[model samples]
Target: MTNHYYRDFLIRNWQERDRIPAAEVIRSVLSEYGLGWEPNGADKDVLQVEEYYLATGGEFWVIEYQNQLVGTGAYYPIKRSEKAVEIRKMYLLSSVRGFGLGKYLLQQLEAAIASRGFLSIWIETASVLAEAVKLYESNGYMPATGVETTRCDRVYVKSLMTNFY
Candidate 1:
């Protein structure tokens, strides 16, 4: 899950010990966007990245900058006939906002999915997450036709067939 380093940043696969710190990174970023963190909610998946992401024929990645877990991103398998994955938990601390790390993470995630032979990627995001929406759109994620409720109001999709991983 490594990408050419972003400054001193290194991307690595999510490990069991990263659970708490990774959740902190995610929660921190969400908080900046005025999003509330409710542990009792469905976001409990953030606390169990292994079971919901890694163990589900998918993967989660953490980016370390200066030995600190500053960013987190993950893609997990979903019930789609075309070998699809959902990009989830993509967030970064405000300190790393303009360093091109988000783009790198998106690139790496798509490569990881394509490496595993997945055909497409799907993502859901709230309308309030303008930066995230821009990142997704710039990374080739277009509007998805599916109807999704219960969480995000915007859904996006991108096909990862160019390099075939």
Candidate 2:
């Protein structure tokens, strides 16, 4: 099944057409990660691609299946930094896992980041997301230690130029 399935996926910078599906997929993925809940009057906590679009000139890629959104990923410049970008808010619907979509997304994100003159990229995922960690490792990202953050996340970093095929 994995080899036979091909995603009708299109990745682009955020646009008005993507508002609802992007929001819903983000909410669903965050819920799966236990990070979806938002308190009343805290709508700002929701990470909307459109909002990031306006703020950081960030780029968003949405995966669609039969015209329905099923996955997304984004890249944004890190603040106070030069030539560095962060791969943020990457998620795919559960049904799409194990078919190499994650690898594709990572490669696309790295390409986008590098195109913008960024020399390196980093991502932080929950330590419990072992599959994600392995994906990063297999893609040449090294585990980063001693990152102090409240989220207790596991950090991974990779230099974009080191292992290009």
Candidate 3:
């Protein structure tokens, strides 16, 4: 389902070949905010994208710029609210900030989740990620609780039942 192309960037489904570069991109982005990549803890999914995402009812995507893996975003059905899905692993390289790619990827994820019959979407993020918080809030993700990750301080949810798209 590689249908998105913005400027010179491309968004496509994750492949086995993307594992290493994708992990590098994710770790590099996390390090920018003084966060560590917890492959055995918070980020265990990155190491098992097949089992945790694709093998389940979820999808994971990789972002490419000039043929280089630069970002990632994914969502998996969670036992949360009605038909809920948790948006996870959204990260972009520092050089790609302010380019609207994050917003585009988020919108794409929402569309996919809704199309898959998900009624609500949840996101857990740290307050340190001011831009991410702003993006989610601006896109109608209201404040919520139940943050399960140790690194995250907040959780936000958007009800897709009211969304026309």
Candidate 4:
């Protein structure tokens, strides 16, 4: 809704009830791709907010510009893996797609995750999200074999270290 020239959007932490709007954007976008994300089911984390994202040594950021939420990105350490973090819930409004906000959010999230001492950032995206796959590929993410999840098919990993394998 915010259509102003306010330079770069600001990334803010997801506060209480903040997930409502974020979920709206996410569900709307996912529905466009014929995907389903149920809040009380598969995406219960969005409902719990702090308990799932913040309390766990991870972060969720909402991109706001001129007081309107436009995008979101989140990360948390992979289960049972101390050296890796999983990138999650990246979505941007259709009106703001070509503005490089997705790339910006990825770069920023990578930096933040690395700074948290994570050696790698992991991502799982659907085969349908070509632009997202391209963004991750261009950002130095390598296709990786990992735990199979029903949420997505393509898996990518970004190493925060040069030779930490």
Identify the candidate with maximal TM-score: 3
TM-score of each: 0.89, 0.78, 0.97, 0.88
Cα lDDT tens digits, model 3, 18-131, are: 989989998998899999899999998998999999988999999999999999999999998879999999999988888999999999999999998899999999999999
Instruction: For model 2, give the 10-residue run with minimal summed lDDT.
Output: 37-46
lDDT of 2 by residue, 1-165 (tens): 011134656555556787667767767766786764342322232345556544776677777777677887777777424566777667788877888888988887776677677877878777766678889889888887655334437877787666455
Off by more than 4 A, model 2: 1-6, 38-51, 145-152, 163-165
Candidate 2 C-alpha error for residue 4, in Å:
18
Each model's backbone clash number: 0, 0, 0, 0
Which candidate leads in lDDT?
3
Clashing pairs in 3: none
- Once fitted onto the true fold, the runs of candidate 4 whose alpha carbons sit more than 4 angstroms away are 1-6, 163-165
Clashing pairs in 4: none
True-structure lDDT of candidate 3: 0.93
Candidate 2's error at 122, in angstroms? 1.1
**For residues 1-165, what per-residue lDDT tens digits would candidate 1 score against the true structure?**
655577788888888889899889977877887877756664788887767886788788888888899988888888754788988888889898888888888888887888888988999888788988999888788897664534578989888775544
Task: Give Cα distance to truth, residue 109, candidate 3, Å.
Answer: 0.4
**Which residue pairs collide, candidate 1?**
none
For candidate 4, write residues 1-165 as lDDT tens digits.
112232577777887767788888788777878888877765677677788778888888887876777777888777535588888889887767888889878877877887778888888898887889999999898998874557688988877887446
Candidate closer to the true structure by TM-score (higher is better), 3 or 4: 3
